[model samples]
Target: MKPLVSATFLTLASGSIGAQAAEIGATFEKPCPFGDCSAGIAFTFLGETSIQTGFSEADVEFGGISGLDFDQATGRFVALSDDRAERGPARVYELDVDLSAQGLQGVSVRRHISLLDVGDIPFAPQSVDPEALRLGPEGFYWTSEGGGSSQLPPSVRVSFPDGKHLREFALPDGFAPTAEGSSGIHDNLAFESLTMLPSGDVLVALEAALQQDGPKPGLMLGSPARMVQFDVLSGKPKAQYVYMISPVPQAGVDGEKAMNGLSEMLALEDGRILTVERSFAEGAGNTIKIFMVDLSNATDVSHISSLARHEDLIVPARKTEVLDLNGIGLRPDNIEAMAIGRAGDGTEILLLAADNNFSARQKSQFFAFEIVQRLQ
Candidate 1:
């Protein structure tokens, strides 16, 4: 924990900035973990802060922030809650995250926008499980993992900034759950990651393997998860690739309880993506790892209905590990969201958020890092 400092307000001709700068009083730096560090970027741990549990605004309980996106034009962030309409209406919150040359200054909530259905009404309880979110050309694009037990299918939808329903994208038949458990996403493991590419396409990733793909990740064996890319205009899947999830980093007290999966992703300008893989064990806590995934040579498995049958016929996405939070000397929580932004000095920064599950023992933690690119 770091000492909290007073907030410094900044004003612009357009209006007053939403968040004020306050010092968190912590800093650290680590070089890239992979080969050729001189040609890669280093992560400078800036600072960290947390929102009090049970915090509320606009009548909505604020927690379960599973996805995030930075708004460069407005200098704000949109955080999506995976509440499933349990505490209140499913929603997204506008936040002002103060980042300065020194480090991450502070974070404040500005407003909450309730996501609506086709009739412009707020989603009913258990109807949708909103997860990953990203800013797109038309508006904000978000994902719903849906309820596997209740047989509610997963969805990717576009919503206006005000949270009004724009349209829902069509998904492939492979994503639909079946009563026999023969195919589709497993319970609570559907679309947990989403990103918009430079080509106006969007990609959504499953948190774990589908029933037909293989078994869930274990301490000794990894699983195969799917990443589907959709055409923004047609809302149709153009391609799908396999991203092999790592096995659980550590085993839990109960061997069957440990698990690992892909949680979030951010598309980069160089046709690569920054991926967040979160593994957790009941008593062992969490292990968060960052990887850069290159899909240039990945075989498109969209035409193949089942990856289990053609495991030897396809090429999975190539990935290179970048950062491991365990090695950074911080006890990470359930980190499920990631975003890229620029600090006041125009330096690229990386931000990560944890989903507390609204548990008293957990925390809504936020970590900031400066992306220091090294020269060759």
Candidate 2:
């Protein structure tokens, strides 16, 4: 949900300062966590663009977009901010998207909705790290990376379109924050990605492996992240699947650390899901790839603990690389959100948004890709 703490390393003078700037809060980089890079499956790259806000009509305090969703019925885009309330209240903005064959035409904020709790109060600044979001039948479904000290198990909640909290879902006890009596998610690395299945189930992904599962991702190995399918309407979990994440592509550069994790996900027809794996290194910039995960033959691991030992017992989701952000030649930032924006003409257009960390050095980036190949 937040950048890893930069580890101390020998600073190389040969690297560019811009690269060092990107390493702010970055941890020490390790080699490819999963040994080597697997070739990604191909997709037609349509167009791409970088969004510049705080200018003209686009002058909106729109940064920290940790989640994204498109309301087809309203032809509007929802960008959820992780800004607890520092700059303003935790909010989601409705936007008008202008996309043509030429590329990303333009995007403008139309309105904003403030998220609230059961007490009818806005989230205090830094109190909650709202990560992933999805459009739901009754309202919006979202996840929050509750802070470390609070012992708040990562949570999923339903909120009205106007930002009223309707209810919260129960998380598996293994995801508890304390490690004394129960296994738990690593602080700050809890729920970061979510999607709504056609079956009306809400699939939530933990950003990293649970503390008891194994060590955090390393260059020579991969970390097993869990995706739980919850029956949203019923407010109960239906199943869980293992979704693995490779270590950061490049460790650290010029003494800066590189890290990677699942940022967002979308459900497709059939029992498949689309996930965004985002990695970042100081000087290397950001690396984002879309992976198609097949849950058809996947085993439910909801009841399984310590995935490391049950590797042979758990049938993890089958993942195929779909698209790599570098192929488009745009300098990628921290791209943490994604959604299907439009589908027509035998292709689907995906809208991707980057979180700026509210840093002057970083620009909130938006990218568009016309997926020429449709998922079967």
Candidate 3:
């Protein structure tokens, strides 16, 4: 692959809100540093920028962003804040991105919708940790990593544009919180990634291994993360596959491996999928990588409760590396959201957003890339 041209970073700050004084800011520039890229399927780093918005009209709360989705009908971006209403009410924001030949021109907040529960009330604080967002036939589909201390099981739910809950998906027993039984999920590690395929199937990926499956990732070896595919309309499971997670890149606090888990995925028209594997080093920053997964030869291990560590026993989905953000000259942050932009001509755009954790040391960042995939 060719090296990216030299560029400078730009930082812009906009005016504040009325009395609450919400601040909106952003910056854009580029300098791709990927090396020895492979062929067949690849992504060209278009550009990247850091964005911050605190508009009273938009009700934008600068917290960790965990999910992202695009509405082609209205050309707006829908984003989910991982906060469970602690900092503010659980909400989603619609944004408008101005794109030009140079790269991303600017970003503007359009609408902010607060999530509501069955009784038509705002979601109670510390109740649901919303993680993923997608446009569905009914309206917008969202997923939450249920609170572990409260023994709340992770869930997928649908709601109208106004944030009124329509229905919740029935999850498998294995996904219940640890307090439920021995086969449930680990604390803070549940359904973190979600995607809807073109074939009317929704894929939900577990953040880490289940209590009955195996242990979490270690210093050198990785752990197996399970992915479940189900009928979006009926919520009936159709298939399941194992996705191995790489170990943390560096040591963590109190002598533990930092963290490495599946963040998001994009279902392709050809049945295969592109997934993001994110790793965080306590002191080294983040390592975000994209893999193209081939499901043609994947085995459905739904019936098997505990997958053996035998090298030859497990047949996981085949993965091929397509992009790595570490080498792209952009500061690595917690990237939890990924989405595919509307296709134009024969090319498609991939958009990525980072969660800032509402910290002054961190930032809410965004990146864009163009993908060129040929029909095989």
Candidate 4:
């Protein structure tokens, strides 16, 4: 946390989307995702410095909220609620797009997917995966985290409305898959970030596992994180890209609670790939970094550059932790989603969102930045 950024008590602004023009706007319900003490904030950026963020869940609307997704077609949003677990219950709601409406807009329950529906995954006590969400190139692609103690393989399976689900194959045996928690099941593998390739392949992020010192399960060291390209047609890994973020790209990055954030990955229309990471250093509450990658130039793992290091459009947080803008321990207050969009002005914009961790301590907020031509 870089010295609390001097925050302004929350407020509401009503305008005709004119002049001061909304640069970015987000929508989210309560039981925010970052912490347990703060309300969730959300935003959707319309490029050209137009941003809008609001607390639509509990505090502002229903008095509580959870995980959510937006439907551009419906011009509305949906959130997940719960009966209470490590995370919370998996409740869903419908959000009205007309924020300009004065009085409180009522929320309606639509879908309620709970942890009990979580099957056999051995990971966090929570069911909904915080952060790692994307309108996957595969259309309707979302991910979940496992570890902590999940016996089920930490996997990312695509669940379709018709009941058709497609999942990446889990590593066989005690091979120990990497990502979230560990159920001690040999085939336990956790997937964090994911992107669909031009070839119709899915590039999935895998955080390799760690072996303990004492009995087979004492302290875990970690392998490394890599982008495993999978040929969906074959349901197997076709290629792997090592990540410098981890010491053992094959295992996982070392010396951390876990190689925390491998947020989201996207292959741009021009062929360049952009990836997001949350390197929460001691007291760095939630430090989000973006890397612009050129697969053509990236012969190996050594080719990725920090978006912050270069001048080409680096987007840092306008807000860090919900509590102490300067403190770290703030569990999950980082940008988990990013998408490149073009505005009405013919300018390019980068949109980002923070995972509230469904905790009252954090807010479900979204942010936006312009990836300068230099970074592009």
Candidate 5:
């Protein structure tokens, strides 16, 4: 076992985005002492940075970064903003992240692309809530949680690097949002996780249990979340699996606002996945947990319309707790995005981003971790 190390804090000079620089405060820590290391893999905290809340470029706001992915080809990071066109046009920003053996150096915006609809125009306000992003063979693949007020069903779409609409994958009927709430995804709890498998297939997962699947996660009982895998060539769902989400850790101060749900996922080259589950309470801050899930023995529930009806016969995906951020001795914000990147020496690095919700109280925080794998 690795000995516990103390935390180091640093205030890095602001990195320039276009012409303006955003101040960043960073913290560095050693490997998580409470993480599960029996699996021969571990995560060591590299460092973290927080951009100023109101950072902007070209008259567009730079908050609400709900989804993030690194592009090796371009050596840039693509960050999706879930603005819903309220602050500006829905968009994605390309970021340049500097890292080394010491830890994170700085982060800066490189480019901003406005997401366009079929009409080749930016989506109007209250029309889309993009939550997940992945770089694909043809273009960029992203998912929108959909809006209940606008009656927009959750969607998976591909677009050119310039943000031109390409095509959309047809979601299963169970994902459609309804006003009566008889069935379908709960409000603001649709698809929030997306990843492209090594085989070129696409996978998207729900944030929480669907209305028909079961009840939302509570203190004692977890919720059943669904994951749908689609064939990239056909844009059709090929398989679906259930992922049981951890219940809320603590009751909110108000007794009704605390919640926990799957936020994002990163597919490993070996067919496994690392999932991020984030919980937030009214008085307490966020609780972030990372789990490694293996789907090899998981039963496909594509034909099973409602998991609640056939709960007895389903085998949900097997998951093992990997890292719990609470043990790192730092309070985490609303972390909703995860991506894999590379350090200066080619070591694998894990990157995480938090959604500020365009609120002044919250922060646009980014974290980097070195991926350490021990050979047996």
Candidate 6:
């Protein structure tokens, strides 16, 4: 898909700025309301440098990334960007990776899945790009930008490495869907960030905030950021968890604090799920929080919800500061993409990627950390 949006509304102070830089427009494989495109705004990668686009103030090629996935069986990395960096009928590329040598600078042999010919679904809007994706038991599963227009179920697809085939995967009921009317329907949707567990369970982040297309245009935004499980074959949503972004220390989160923004979510193999919460709404202290929630033990995420009577389950996530130690500023915008991997010695690495909003003011960097197992 092309970048989510060509322009972004930035909230800046001398020390920090909170807002999405530019978003990649959603596109399928061919030109149409739904097609593959290369118009991207930001990128996240799993290489030697781990989300290392760390430029705090630099102009970047927009429409650079749509989503990312890593193959555990082969250590191969695939970053889906708007194909050809254009605005329609985009293609998905598969990158062969070897992090053993390079960091974010790792080398990748690339392949493309052209989506210029998939027949459009009924009632879908024009220019919807494939914004986010996940690697499923079947293959790659993704969501588009159309859940805003017609309640079209988030689009799911499977991409096989053979390159001769790319198929569409259908979204079944209960898997959870996103609603529009928030700040913008451009990048945020019903199921923006998706992840699958080794146990066959799935977690999806519904950008339950407003679906309007601008910066903080709404006085208020709301939605239950949901996580659900589905049967591999039938594609039925089996379970769900709902939660919220913390209301700033002063917002007094006495009501339903909305979980409006998220760049990515990763399902830990140990049954815990981690997420990057990018709240642009007023009163939400926007940060790249890596939450460690035990979804295996809880069925409903209401426990994680901090309503007037509930206590939020999200703990104070230990974040890797790319500033001071790294010179990156405090507003690391959208730094929540994740990957579960192993370092050379076999210790598990929780790799988190941040979206720098591609503005001339933030860092286009990524980070990798060892999950201080035992959660001390």
**lDDT of each residue in 277-341, candidate 2, tens digit only:** 88877877888877777787788887787786774667788886655556434467888899876
lDDT by residue (tens digit), candidate 5, 162-264: 8999989988977897888877888898999999888889999999888889988889989999999999988999999989999898888878688999999
For residues 1-376, could you state the per-residue lDDT of candidate 3 as single tens digits?
Answer: 2212222223222111122311121221121112212323445555667766342444446657889888878767788889888887788888776655566655566667888888778888888899988888887788898856679888998888888888888887577866654667777778888898879888998887877777677678687888988888887777889888777667776674488888888887666677888888675678888777776678888877667533457788877666566643455588999987642221245779888878777777887665555333
On a 0 to 1 TM-score scale, where does candidate 4 land against the true structure? 0.51
What's each prediction's TM-score?
A: 0.88, 0.82, 0.83, 0.51, 0.88, 0.56
Query: Considering summed lDDT, which 10 consecutive residues are worst modelled in model 5?
Result: 14-23
For model 3, give the 10-residue run with minimal summed lDDT: 21-30
Alpha carbon lDDT at 230, candidate 3? 81
Off by over 4 Å in 6: 1-66, 82-89, 94-112, 115-127, 145-153, 162-187, 209-223, 248-260, 281-286, 297-333, 342-348, 356-364
Model with the higher TM-score, candidate 2 or 5: 5
- Looking at model 5, how many pairs of residues clash? 0
TM-score of 2: 0.82
Tell me the lDDT of model 4 at 95: 38
**How should the candidates be ordered by TM-score, best one leading?**
1, 5, 3, 2, 6, 4
Cα-based lDDT for every prediction: 0.81, 0.71, 0.72, 0.38, 0.80, 0.42
- Output the lDDT of residue 17, model 1: 20
Candidate 4 lDDT: 0.38
Clashing pairs in 3: none
CA displacement after TM-score superposition, residue 248 of candidate 4 (Å): 15
Tens-place lDDT per residue, model 6, 1-376, is: 2221222223122123233331112111111101211211122212324223332112223223546676677565555543222332344445443333233333333555544325432212243445566776666665554444554455555554532235544443333234533322333455567777767755555554323212321235333445545555666555555444433222324543433355567664444555655554344434444444445344453233222234445322122211111111233444545565644434344455444443454433445433322211
Distance (Å) between predicted and true CA of 294, model 2? 0.5
lDDT of 1 at 361: 85
Model 2 segments beyond 4 Å from truth? 1-43, 53-60, 179-182, 309-312, 343-348, 372-376
